[model samples]
Target chain A: MNSEILNIPLNDYKTTVESLKNEGFEMMMDLTVVDWFRKKEPRFEIVVQFLSTSHNKRKTLKTFVNDEDLSISSITDIYPSANFYEREAFDMFGIIFENHPDLTRILMPDDWVGHPLRKNYGSGRIPVQFKNAPKVD
Target chain B: MKDYKVKKSKLSNFKNKLDFWATNSEEGGWNISSTDEGSQKMLENENEEQIKIQTGTEVLDDFVIDEETSDDERMIVNMGPQHPSTHGVLRLQAELEGEVVRRVKPIIGYLHTGMEKTGEELNYFQGPTNTTRMDYLSPLFNELVFSLTTEKLIGIEVPERAKTIRILMTELNRISSHLVALATGGMDIGALSMMIFGFRERELILNFFEKTTGLRMNHNFIRPGGVAADLPDGWQKDVQEILKVIPEKLQDYDDMLLDNPIWKGRLQNVGILTTEECFAYGITGPSLRASGYSWDLRKSQPYSGIEKFDFEIPVLNEGDVFARWRVKVLEIFESLKIVEQSMHNMPKGPYKIQDKKITPPPRKRLDESMEALIHHFKIYTEGFKVPEGDAYVAIESPRGELGCYIVSDGSSKPYRMHVRGPSFCNLQALPVIMTDSPIADAVAAIASLDPVIGDVDR
Candidate 1:
């Protein structure tokens, strides 16, 4: 199947990315951090998705990071496009990248407290209006 | 300050840093910059300690770049959290040398709804609701990709009729999205007449969407198993009307914008990028196509029976503002052609999966069959479960390749769902292409890029 998952070790994440780039994964399709808080041993999984336009295939490299140590090698060197994705990972999961060019939050505010995407973070919701049709009664 | 960072990498071979400084030009067309190596400068130097306080989300780092330089000929200008040209709340911080732009950093996330994280709380069936909102212009593509990924994981084929409906609706959506792109590009550049004409056709297509799905935007019609409902009666007539009207309108646009001297002057050779730069920066869809690469997901990676349709993928080699404008305009005709074919080959049968576990029983069945009543109740209340696995599906949206990655854990709710929004990835090409252009062309570049900030931020 074109859609397949490959487990990438936390330590070997950079090498895996480097090898994939050599094998013609032209672009990093999407890079996201999945927080499987209660289900998995490592609290975070840095999911890196790559697309090889030459071969017409998709490969997903997932590296696990525990809650205590949230860090991974940045793939910006392999793909300059990883600039924003890596920063987004840091913003949401607190997964510090080793060598990102600019590891600033891409989607969240500068002063926003805590990684809101973390499983433990509050709902990030506020019940303001239109709850069960306005209370005309 | 950025010109001096030397933390070495294999791909770090470039001259003159792409840094940011706020511009105070009363007219605010472009900017100017230089350094005499000593005296007071109007462009205030960012206080190192103050950048630490104002740094949004990056960890503060120490002195790396030489603060004072021999050349003080650069000025940074912020594009928009509110500027009309920028489609939405996209802020481009550019470092300029007089009229030429040296660097552009796109600061986004003003419209972030955090929908990806929230998708985990919703089950497989409820996924479309969250995803459809991601790419607000091409909402159906968002729903279609999410549904396709989940369907791949669950290992089920949607009924042929549903697949056909999806193709038809999304193709129509593609036309409307591109219309918005054309309109905004026209309004951003100096083609004011193109703006009014573009919205007129878009309004007609939106009426079709309202008929098929209840809502005008964010229609969660495409479900995991199939579409939420079958095509409404007389949808064929509406589809035919759209197909007939768009081609004629496109011909009119060709007259107004295509060969017009002013349009050519503003767009031609502006914001040029080679095919390698397009590939390197992960730009897809029209932007990549404009660079003369025919790497469309619909053609290369066929989905929802797009392979069966007969259409030509437009390719433009110029890779500039005018080339992208031409590329999108041509693709609209191609999309209209797909809608025509879909209407001709419309399948007749159930519009959703027949499996009771995945799809609810029909309304009439609820009256006669007890099992149907129970199944309908359970399906709506709890939703269907997807087997433990992940699927990544990419399809061509108007802006670029819109992809979605869904991970399920054999539970009702998803483990993770991520949308690789085309605008988000395509916007990366901005800094790469904008580093050496005039400021006016940079606006044209941003407009030609057609970044819907909702999609970019989401």
Candidate 2:
């Protein structure tokens, strides 16, 4: 077991990815977008969580992407499980995963019109189609 | 199978009649006039105070229609939305040929409560309520991940006593979560005795939890800076009593199933997940550990003062149903060790952070100090704002590496929140595991995976 795992900064995503690749980090566990609406230029941030089984190390790579075009290089080729996660990001946050195979909605249907996780997304109550409505209290 | 086909067609025709009645009844005139004589006759016979009846039998009929038209060459089996074995509203559409499952597509979203979006709208203090809903069975771990991330982002130092209490509660929750998985998983695979044993032991743990957190299931005790309140008196004694009793109960469980030929036959060499595959699917906790990977957040990252306690990360090379079960069972012992150590090293200090901005003043000071009263009023009305930053925190939950990613724009509420639910990720491997396996074995595979549908759907 390694004595210490390094905490890399968010600015050096490309370098960190290359370093992790060199260090035998073969799996990209999860990729998600966190929207920091208070930030000036790039209000949205992307978190790339990785796991290296050989070295038994886990690292989170963070980066800021503009809300105008939320795009990230696809890690599906590196880790097949990433396909669904990236598709989920697209479905929930409107972040586009470039070069991802089968990059359609995985959880929600294809026709789901809006990204539900964004800060500005309206929270319209979905009408209950069942007999007993949920208690109002 | 032949009998089902005949009944299914009859049910579909009945459903068509029901739909026609519903739609045509709204169109007025002709439809109402045609049915008026029969309706009037029925109304006259019925009592005035009789309750109106609506049948969910239509839903059952619709499912039969969906089953019949699905395809003849393939056998379509619906595994739960209500079935006890699916572990909570998870429905699977499995295509089978005889006993072998050809393909399985998991149909989720039955438990969708929009928790991630709800977290964004709620303030930091109220965030635990949303977290508690994700993994309802293991709510403390959900609260732990969110609280840890918020604390890291804001850079607040939780008191030593609070940290020790957090570790104790977290380990206890882990044991409870494993017991639930064991109970439900065993029942899924047709082991009735194991289910009873698992739940019996689980009730003891939940009893201990109720004493500390004031709730059995959704204990919103852990918060951003620290725990909600100080440990109740004699808490250490209760924990020690549980620690002393659980070891023997766990051994009884092992005797009942671990070496039994029937249990071994069903679990061994079933649903094999390779090391590469486990990593690819982002599998963690006991599931990943079973694949011979010794990755545990408590040992590796050491959040909430977990480094103070010593415990082993159990690993198995088989990576099958039995191996996963073994890892979880062994983890119960290790969690007990952590809990014992945490109790021994319990410190004395304030439970929550002392900052008036983050934590409200004590009730006694509200009447004494004007500043305390003002601070309490402000914090409750407009919650403390987090810094403008983002952080992702992951914990070794019973099922896997449950993670939370939060972004705060210096506001009381999170701008955006996303959960890296292990069940959601681990469930993706179901299709891979079920292919070519016997349809019965698919249930065992899913049971061993222990995918909670609430976590998956959220």
Candidate 3:
């Protein structure tokens, strides 16, 4: 019910987050990217949730990232915990987080080919071959 | 390149060392630079030896010392991806200078099945089944958060009985989860009897769960509208039995390990995480509380009528492995208290909401009424639709604050569904806790954190 969402432009993103940190939103609770693909322009939306323990308040921040330019400023400097969350967002959505300490894959294997969570990516499975079993054509 | 040995110092000097370690630990302890030929050659030689050992070609050397390496030399060691203490498939690449752990990087994802991606494929009604598997230990908490998010998006209030049932089951789940944490934590610290006692008590709660939910682990009992079914007959008797027995067992555990010197030595003052570090690292729940930050989602956020129940959030200023362990033990008593309160104050009513769009018609109603029959047929076939919006709901899971974020585009299936697993966030604090500690204490630190790999890699 505490739907206090702040939609900020790309330019003001870092400054807004820095101010939020200064304003006592000490914890960056969750960071994730929502890919819209053909449904909406600026194909990706970065959603972040911040919690201020002192005030018991939660704020949700939303920012858009275009598919052509998938890079965004990382908030890891403000919240060291954003390190893994940023890596996960990068791993799943292929959105580049500029200045992230280690922006490599966190959940997926390093050799994995594509970002699996992207809407454009197919959710296909590999066929299992059973040894010494008859195959049905 | 300089000598890295920390000298024995006074209390104030040790505090300074802790502060220095806190800042420098983030750089990661055991990094091998590509340009550093000596360390890189040592690494390659170690790998070659590993290959030889695997192929049964190398002789086992228990105490072979190389003259090339100095006394203060640091070497990289892999604790697991297989080691019993690393919990499950968690590979920790530690930088060790003798028995001391200089740095640790927890490499996970071996158990990753992409549950978040799987959640998108499932509709709102079937969402719990996917989320429930994320935190296997507290499966109900996962389901509860997912259902809470869905219910938030739909703007529907469940019945009082349903809310009470959710509280009752989740509190019981918290006890079972903490019991496993205690068991594993005790086992890691060499308190084998404590492990057995912990599991023995846990079996009683698990039996109650098995009787009610019909599954031991991933019970998708908590749904969007409400719970799957009503509590079975004689449920109160089972509840009473758990309440009567666990307190005595807890007393026995206290008698066994409370003042034991070995237990204190292994856990106390090891893996000290202060409140500032907890906030910066986004640590929550008992780990944060153990650091003296008195915040619990159950107390502060209060979901599913949880605030109606009376319970205290245990806090300790030490923030060491002992404090984390002690916080969890104290939390079990608090959860038991909540369970008892919910059982006594439970109101009789419908299990789920009576909305025709959400809850399906009863079996008896389906036989009598054509409208009810149509409703039942439609509900299961396509599931219910949610309004166009996004909502994030957080609840105090045993691990920490487990949150679910759902984005809906006016459809039965969520456009995007993401679970903020506490284990995933809590794993980031590993370097801070494990760095500069002894190898054995590293195990204790990890055990105290109590991260479920399923939850972390999900």
Top candidate, metric TM-score: 3
- Docking level of model 3: acceptable
Using lDDT as the yardstick, the better of models 1 and 2 is 1
Which of 1 and 3 is the better model by DockQ? Answer: 3
Q: Pull out the clashing pairs in model 1.
A: A110-B56, B33-B72, B33-B73, B33-B74, B34-B71, B34-B72, B34-B73, B34-B74, B35-B71, B35-B72
Per-residue CA lDDT of candidate 3, range B1-458, in tens?
Answer: 13333343455476655655754432322233322321112223233322221121111111233467675588888777777877787878787778766556677788999888888888888899999998999999999999999999989899999999999999999999999999988998899998899899999988988888899999999999999989989999999999999999999988888899988877788888878878888999899999888999898889999878888888998888889999998999999999999989989989999888999888899879999888898888788999999999999999999989999999899999999999989888887777656787788888999989999999
Q: Score the docking of each candidate (DockQ).
A: 0.31, 0.26, 0.38
Residue B17, candidate 3: how far off, in angstroms?
59
For model 2, which pairs clash? none
- TM-score between predicted and true chain B, model 1: 0.84
User: Quick one: ranking by TM-score, best first?
Assistant: 3, 1, 2
Q: Cα RMSD (Å) between model 2 and the true structure?
A: 12.0
Worst-scoring 10-residue span by lDDT in model 1 chain B: B54-63
Flag regions of model 3 displaced more than 4 Å.
Answer: A125-137, B1-72, B368-370
Which is the leading candidate under lDDT? 3
Q: Give the TM-score of candidate 3.
A: 0.87
Candidate 1: lDDT of A12? 83
Candidate 2 local lDDT, B143-207, one digit each (tens): 99999888988988888888888888989999989998998888988889888988999898899
